[model samples]
Target: MGTPFSFDDGTAICLYVINRAPLVEINDEALALHHLSGMGLDPWNPRRMTALRERIHPFGVTLCNNGALSLLTQETQLGWHVPRFISAELAVAQWAREQMGGTEESRNLAEEVEMYLRAWRPHADLIRHPRQRGISGHEHQFDFLQNDELIDVITPHHNATGGLMRKLVDVLNAGDESAPKVRVIVDDRTDPARAGIEMQIIASLAKAMPLSKLLDRVHSGSA
Candidate 1:
């Protein structure tokens, strides 16, 4: 409805990830430390989750929360089965921590959760495909989340690929030197309609930069 957020760089890419666990099923400690203070971890609520998605969209990334990947894969809710393996491990690690008393073993369990979180990092990398970028969640950290650094919002339950693409086109045509390189990451799996919109957006960009010479100087001389 409003202008889509833009980045200074000219790159536009999308990252798609499938969360292995239901939001409620994730580890309590990680959830406690990271979640919205009073909101609880209710990822299924479209209203709450949609607001969260919008806040993080401005960072040159749009995350489709939950199992939207199933749309691309065409398997209904069956899509999350694969990644759930890691999420299950996360649950187990948390369960293990609870079992440990306040001893050296308990300290080790804490370390284990940290390591598990690190392991989950690859999932983002995997989805981003050929590009290198950071993984962000629906809920952001205290700094970005609280400082109002989040740029825009989109509904996670619905396909937001078109919204992402339109923003890119707007940024390119606007010729804003301050615009960041745009990247729209979608799950390898998404509904055909959503994916079709994403393709259309990409086509529009290709049309914009019809020739190498055209793209070479879009903002080359700006300071």
Candidate 2:
């Protein structure tokens, strides 16, 4: 539980020392590139380690042969050929951040649905998030999947609604003989323009069901 090291610009970078090897954890690409540039090395130049010493000097760290830097200690010798390693770490961290963000957003959307369902369809046995399945192999996940029903919860955002609509179309046309019944629940409190577009898309799809309406249907056991 070492105190994290962070840059002055409000971005936190977690550093862990394992077997005397300092590991840097940076989430944002811009922040990683900024730190890389601060070390006087081009972020994209993975083959050059001309500024390795200068980079480690500012943080009082020593670089190891395996490209792990030593934090707050100069016991380890600096390695000259660690540009590729740093670049790889940054790339992987940035990718992981992006993936984590998507997962978090999906989880938030599912939570919203769960809250509504708890109050309305308290006894309904439904899966919160379910894997996508169809002959199309589109890999489109749903917010809720209960029995033969596939429900997608979308924000009032135009892009979010549009994306859900595309997924619905894919599921409908997936050529699967047993495609589940598709449903969409839109948040009523969305930006007016985006909500209008969402409503229009729902009208066109002929399957737009509001959250309240869906709750009623579920409570009435007609869903």
Candidate 3:
């Protein structure tokens, strides 16, 4: 008997009831059949086992070797099923960290940008991280979309902003007349040099509108 093998996909595979019947010792087919029969299942019935696997798939469960079993599910599901496994807040925090690449500073910057946008356009529908299709028919995601504008918040310290900026440019030039106007907000508080580069990229592709300009536009009902 041992702990199951777990995967990041929220699935675990292991011997079933291993404390009593070790998987290695169940060498004979009859023993496997007997073990499955005890659980009210026919070891030879493929359709039944297939149906069972399908039923448990959403819960991240799988069965094998007539006796072995596995459980797979997201962290949220685990927290829900296992009492006191994790607090609701902790689960959400963990999920957010995973989504944001585990960078607290980046997460804070995104939040700041989101808050600013919400305040600026309180009545407009502001979507965070919206997925849209490009000219190539491939889906792409931008940080935020407000009306006819697409906004991205960049951390000056991260060099990946260049690639993201290029993606925005691609989407903008995708021949879609209805494409949103692109804007980027770079936190220039730290690494001002990189922020300058980001600003330049935005300027080259679209208007490198500053935060003040954005606020002004919103106040004047132009955004």
Candidate 4:
């Protein structure tokens, strides 16, 4: 609960406790889409994001500039706000769970990477669900931090593009010297074909690798 930031996509919340009050936020809502259907929900769609803002309004959560929900409490209320925070998490999680149809796929992929790291990268220090602000002032929430590189696990089969812009902007903001290298580890267990478009596009901005081939790439020192 005191962790800096932990993204539980299944619950659609990231807990970042700064000072004493806990700030809970939703990361990359676009991760909700699962298909390329013209009728599919963008999740980051103006309507949905707006609706989320309105929904959280009654709970007194702050609406972030990036169109996400965050619960900010006064320091004096912390001692009595535990229940309120749980309520907020449940409310947001229910709505987000519906959008992404649960995070089973990504959870499976995470487990795989975790096992591999436990076996081969035992000595490697790993930071999961890292949230960092880019030079452009935009924030990026990545899945893992390993080998000094920022890594993300994406199932980008349904996005047209916007869900990726945050990372793209983060990269452009890197400037020449401290440029961050992003690795998109995809959950290709479903259909490798579906990940092609987004993967190719993302590769132009970041490194794209499939979960199946992850061990090989890392073992070969190319990841």
Candidate 2, residues 1-223, lDDT tens digits: the string is 2124433222355444334346343222233443433222233344333245344454444444434544433224323223333444434334323322342454576687777666555666788556564344535556676556777766565546545655566556768666567777776653555555677787665366666565576668663
Best-to-worst ranking by lDDT: 4, 2, 3, 1
* TM-scores for candidates 1 onward, in order: 0.21, 0.48, 0.48, 0.58
Query: After TM-score superposition, what is the CA distance of residue 1 in candidate 2 from its true location, in Å?
Result: 25
lDDT of 3 at 185: 76
Candidate of highest TM-score? 4
The runs of at least 3 residues in candidate 3 whose Cα sits more than 4 Å from the true structure, single-residue gaps closed, are 1-103, 209-223
Compare the candidates by lDDT and give the number of the best one.
Answer: 4
- Over 4 Å off, model 1: 1-159, 177-179, 190-197, 206-223
What is each predicted model's overall lDDT from 0 to 1? 0.29, 0.50, 0.50, 0.55
Q: In model 3, how many backbone clashes occur?
A: 2
Model 2: number of clashes?
0
- List the lowest-lDDT window of 10 residues for candidate 3: 18-27
Better of 1 and 3 by TM-score: 3
Q: Please report, as a residue range, the 10-residue window in candidate 4 with the lowest summed lDDT.
A: 31-40
Error of 4 at 40 (Å): 19
lDDT of 3 at 127: 83
Clashing pairs in 2: none
Clashes of each: 22, 0, 2, 0
